[model samples]
Target chain A: MTAPSAVGISRTTRPLAPPRRTRRGSRLRYTLTVLAFLLPSALPLLAFTIYPMIGAFWTSLHSWNLIGVMEWVGLENYTTLLTDDATRRVFANTLYYVVGYLPLVYIGGLALALALNSLIPARNLLRGIYFLPVVTSWIVVALVWRWLLNPSVGVVNAMLGGLGIDGPGWWTDPYWAMPSIILASAWKDLGFVMIILLAGLQAIPTDVQEAAMIDGAGRFRRLLNITLPLLSPSTFFVVVISLINGFQVFDQVYAMTGGGPAGSSTVVVQQIYDLTFRYSSAGEASALSWLLFLLVLAVTVIQLIGQRRWVTYA
Target chain B: MPERIRRILLTAVVALGALVMFFPFAWTVSTSLSPGVGLDATPQLIPDDPTLAAYRELFANTPFARVIANSLGLAITTTALQLTTSSLAGYAFSRLAFPGRGLVFGLYLATMMIPIQVLIVPLFVQMRSLGLVDTYLGVLLPGVASAFGVFLLRQAMNSVPRELDEAATIDGAGHFRIFARLVLPLVGPALASLAVFAFMSSWNGFLWPLIILRSEHLQTLPLALAGLQGQYTTQWDVMMAGSVVSVLPMLALYLFAQKYVIQGVAGTGLK
Candidate 1:
């Protein structure tokens, strides 16, 4: 009953079909109805996602700009990106982002979750206040941070100046630009992680904490041994997500640094944008895009494999 | 005695953290209201002389009003499209007897794993070939078909009792009849949850829209805000005014539907 599919449909084959056989004359109608429902998503998904995935590979092998003649240059794009010093620095900058970005989000989110989990007045209000940033678009977040960190007349440096300390030029200074983006990114996203962790915290039964308390475990000890161990699954979830997001960071860098005062904050996606649109290097950009995808895929695969050692599912 | 002191310290720390979280936004609003006195050290939080001159100038200088309308129209269109398609695909996956169900769904979920960064250039080529560049249709198409939304709805649809659909089938009711009548009504809560997510993502989506929408008048809030920032790099007051305008609707929506939004997020992320 399975025909060779032209489009990207599921090639599901049962050795002996039951439903189609039973339906008989109405089988075609049933299939049609299913296709009707499926086609809406399937066509667009194939067009937008599946088609482009294949096209990405094909395009990566050709030296083509948007308007110019397409020339076959398989592996050259990859070679250029891998060997070029500038592109190498772009990869390093991406690594720097993930390295600096994830920890701040995890630590800050966990701390906020832990704090909110405890007895507190205006708890929901406080949670809402904390979550306010999460919903704000990254463009807005980047703009806000740019203003706040604008050295000459910004609020942050002004506060630092008031404290009798000179503040460094945040987004302008190559050294501080990435760290500044990390802080802003973490702040904007920490609320989502906090909410997820808070859900985990809530799921941990109060009796477990009580049992630990009655067994002569102090607050810190309980948190270290019992609380954190139980919170592993959620923590693992948050970490994986944080890493993925941290690696693919584009908006903040695009808005705040524009790959910046000597390319300090140039993340991979930013480079891809610059390559594709600015430099009109579609083939090289696609290659870079795939490499970024590979890095994310590799990291995620590694996390999945490694989580077996530490992440307790139950 | 120490426990009390610990609570006090924890409370103080959390409060300070909240201030840090909120200070930028508060200052944005404050700045948006204040006229451009030009840049100076230690800008006033209360803006001793508050004015809406920045807000006025934001509208007067650019197509800020048209940008807002564009954002609203696109967000609503994308949300509607996603909901309909996701719910339909979700229903077929959950209730229908289909071959390769496992394989197809697996492929669909894997798309979620791939970051959108990978798709930008090739997707752009496809759009350009289709002659849809710099159009709302191009911006709306990519986001409207979401695999995660389908997966979420399928799970929601699974909890729906099969007996009801079976009875309907026995009553000679078709898939559409059962789906449109029985299944959808039962899955209202799930639909609502997905709507909030779909709406927010479309509204806040920056990268794809920024790539596709080249024209200024076609720009959504996020893109317009980006353009606005590019134009007025040093006009903190007007930029803040635009920032305030862009962020307020979302903040209000989240507050209005706080429980649904949070629960929706928690459900998706935890799963």
Candidate 2:
């Protein structure tokens, strides 16, 4: 009985020991290697992302300013922001911007990318021209667009006048300011979307298009049936990036309008900035920022969900 | 006849689009060189009297050269740092089998979604605590190890063959040696693209520097240009000159690296 039991134990133990030992060692090495690789970014993320996020949250629950005594205010800041008319209008303006600006940018980018995809002379130059606005600083672009849209002296209105049409006061007028900002922002973001879409277009295998052509499909038919479906992955990418960017639209508005002309162009980010930096209302600003964060997260989640139905990775 | 008409129509449309796209830059240049008050009148394609007065004023009244130098310095240094840090991490992510690697990378990607504006207050606080405010290092440090850069380079590195690494290893090379001798040379184009991207982003950065920098001497070109616009009213020529100064370096870089730049943009989906 002892000999039989010992033989069974030895047979079982020999097979298991090597794999278990190797697994433990490999896991340990992998953990160390990953940590080593991540150290640089991890440190900053902790300092800048995690710590600040936590600090901002804590600050949002208090009434504190630079060089002032801190006082805990509970949820008063949140409640006040919810009821305030000015704050409400800022949120509305941001929503209006998101609704108005995203379509122009996305559609314009897609059209341009498609058009550019066809063999054209000076395609490189054309791509450069389209992308120029993107590399230019927002401050400079804002200033230049402002100059170009100046009611009396601007070239844009001058061109309209050449056609015997009137152009609105783009920046000064309350009614036209948000639209003007949107136009400028769209121009800036157009190149970005074009690049993404172009990448998508390039990734679509030529065989599919050839097959469609062999099947007697016209160019439009091919694009509608094959290219568009295949390009959905990139399109989905553009949609997600654009939506996230649209929510964080700040620089152009800040530089050009400053949420002026009866606060028509006021966006939530601008309001958060003003509250925290300008007015020293850290608590309220933090609340507003968190709200903005939640909105962005929700939109991102929606896009992710939609992507399953629409996006074709290959 | 119909085909000719279609070709002509397409050409005309494209030409018109190009002109519209380029008109603003042309106008800015024309206005910058215009002699006097004429620029403030109805904008024109050609300046009535092209003069260098604005350029003279731009250099005279402001630290225009210094501001440009500061921008170049920050951009170059940041790009260099980003390339080194991101490439190492990218290599590790691509080749090394590390525990929690997927979880760590996912966390890194998640940081990309966090709106930068949310970080401003806390970043400012942290920088102030470290006494880094008003310094170039402060502006450059936080951005050196970009998650996007790491992700991008890692994606690029994945395309490189494993045989090369194995060959180098068999030749008595260590991990770092194999990386330096074998991997670095193969991914040169990708690295170049990343460098250009990193440079442009750093050069055009506004809000972060605007918040951190207070001293006039230390201000970047955008901040300086904004200040110039605010200080002088109706000095369109001078302002335009400042704008040209700010844009010229970028234009020069773009013209020189047109091929690589386009390839980079097309490959990376960078704006």
Top DockQ: which candidate number? 1
Residues B1-271 of candidate 1: C-alpha lDDT, one tens digit per residue: 9989989899898988899888888988987887864365557898888988999899998899999999889878988999999999998788765667678888888888877789999999888999899999999989878998899889998999888877787797778898899999998878877887787888889999988888888989998888887698778889999999988888888888888777776776567
- Stretches of candidate 2 exceeding 4 Å from the true structure: A1-37, A214-219, B1-5, B38-40, B269-271
Query: What stretches of model 1 exceed 4 Å from their correct place?
Result: A1-23, B1-5
- Cα deviation of A257 in candidate 2 (Å)? 1.4
- lDDT tens string, model 1, A165-272? 999999999999998998888889888999999998888888989988999998789999988988888998888888888888898898898889789889889999
Q: All models: lDDT?
A: 0.85, 0.79
Clashes of each: 1, 1
Maximum-lDDT candidate: 1
Q: Candidates' interface RMSDs, in order?
A: 3.5, 5.8
Model 2: per-residue Cα lDDT over A1-314, one tens digit each:
01122233335443111112235565455346445666766777667777888887787788878547779998888898889998889888988998998899888888888877776667777878888887788888988888888888888898898899999988889999999999888888788788889988988889989988899999789888899989887777777777888888888887788888778898988898888789988778887888788889999999889888877767
Prediction 2 global C-alpha lDDT: 0.79
